[model samples]
Target: EAGVAQSPRYKIIEKRQSVAFWCNPISGHATLYWYQQILGQGPKLLIQFQNNGVVDDSQLPKDRFSAERLKGVDSTLKIQPAKLEDSAVYLCASTGTSGVHEQYFGPGTRLTVT
Candidate 1:
């Protein structure tokens, strides 16, 4: 099976600006997730989707960050008025119906806010 696909592997932006990242998960996967990984810490789950419906978003920074899974296939994450603290590698991952233990990740989009 093909791996998850993400766009613009790298991006640099000015603080307070807006940026967006895209992801296309593997076919047949029903669950999708977005995560943020800072320089020294493990990836933090930002949001999760079970087919077009959001399963969890409590960890997401609602004030500046938003995400959606359209048609339960492709997903997008956006940050408006970006902050220096938001600079991190935004990762997209997905898991098959079998379970979360088999999640696959994409080559994350590295965002640098300056």
Candidate 2:
């Protein structure tokens, strides 16, 4: 069984630029999530999706951050007019809702806002 998948392991851009990340979850997983991890801090949930529908995104910055799960499978996260504070790692995870919600994380995309 494969874990989650993410693209562009690393990225660097000047502040105010836009950036996007991609993710593909493991097969059979029913839920997917996007998280932002700042250095020295635990990951913060940015959004969650159950199949192709959005389940949660209250923590996501509506001004510049957006995400979507397509056909209940692949997902994408985008940040426009990114600020310097947006420099962090974007992680993707997936899990089944059968009893445990133990999520499997992907190799995250590291974004550097200069």
Candidate 3:
């Protein structure tokens, strides 16, 4: 009974550099989500994946941000030419299939772009 997994729990880079984050959702969980959370603000949904297919990404900044769920399990999020305003916590969460689907969040990757 393990939870979601994310790597490189912290990252720092200069503006204009690129950064990537990884996530592995729980077994059998069909829905996965990536969220961006700025300090003092609630997390904003960046993208969502149901299995290996994308469900939503309208809020994501296409020019600088991208994400994918591979094989319906593992996922990655990348930000290119990072901006100083992109400094925030990137969180990965997953949920089950039941009606009362509870979402589990990973220890976010905090990105600091100088």
Candidate 4:
């Protein structure tokens, strides 16, 4: 099966600018997640989708970050008016949810804001 795919391994941006990232999860997976991982820290959940429906987005910054999974296959995450503190690796993962936390992650999109 095709693994998850992401783009722009790294990105440099200034505060108050906007940026977006893309992700394509594995096939036949039922759950997809987007996480923000700060340097040397564990990945923090930003949003989660169960199939085509959104399961959770509690940690997502509504003021700037937004995402969508219209077809339940590929997803996109966007951050507008970026902040310096937003510098982190954005990882996309997927799991079938047939068992407990069985998730596969993408390489991630790293963002650096100045």
**lDDT, model 3:** 0.94
Give the per-residue lDDT of model 2 (tens digit) for 1-114. 788999999999999899999999999888999999999999999999999998999999999999988789999999999999999999999998699768899999999999
Compared with the true structure, model 3 gives a TM-score of: 0.96
The sequence of per-residue lDDT tens digits that candidate 1 reaches over residues 1-114 is 899999989999999999999999999898999999999999999999989999999999899999988788999999998999999999999997774577799999999999
Each prediction's total of clashing residue pairs, residues at least 3 apart in sequence or on different chains, is: 0, 0, 0, 0
Candidate 4 residue 20 Cα shift, in angstroms, is 0.6
The pairs that clash in candidate 1 are none
How well does each candidate superpose onto the true structure, as a TM-score?
A: 0.96, 0.96, 0.96, 0.94
Each model's lDDT comes to 0.94, 0.94, 0.94, 0.93
Candidate RMSDs in Å, in order, are 1.0, 0.9, 0.8, 1.2
Itemize residue pairs with steric clashes in candidate 3.
none
Name the lDDT of candidate 4.
0.93
Q: How close to the true structure is residue 12 of candidate 3, measured as C-alpha lDDT?
A: 94
What clash count does candidate 2 reach? 0
- Which lDDT tens digits does candidate 3 get at residues 62-87? 99999988789989999998999999
What does the lDDT read for residue 96 in candidate 2?
Answer: 83
For residues 1-114, could you state the per-residue lDDT of candidate 4 as single tens digits?
888899878999999999999998998888999999999999999999998899999899899999999998889999999999999999999998576687999999999999
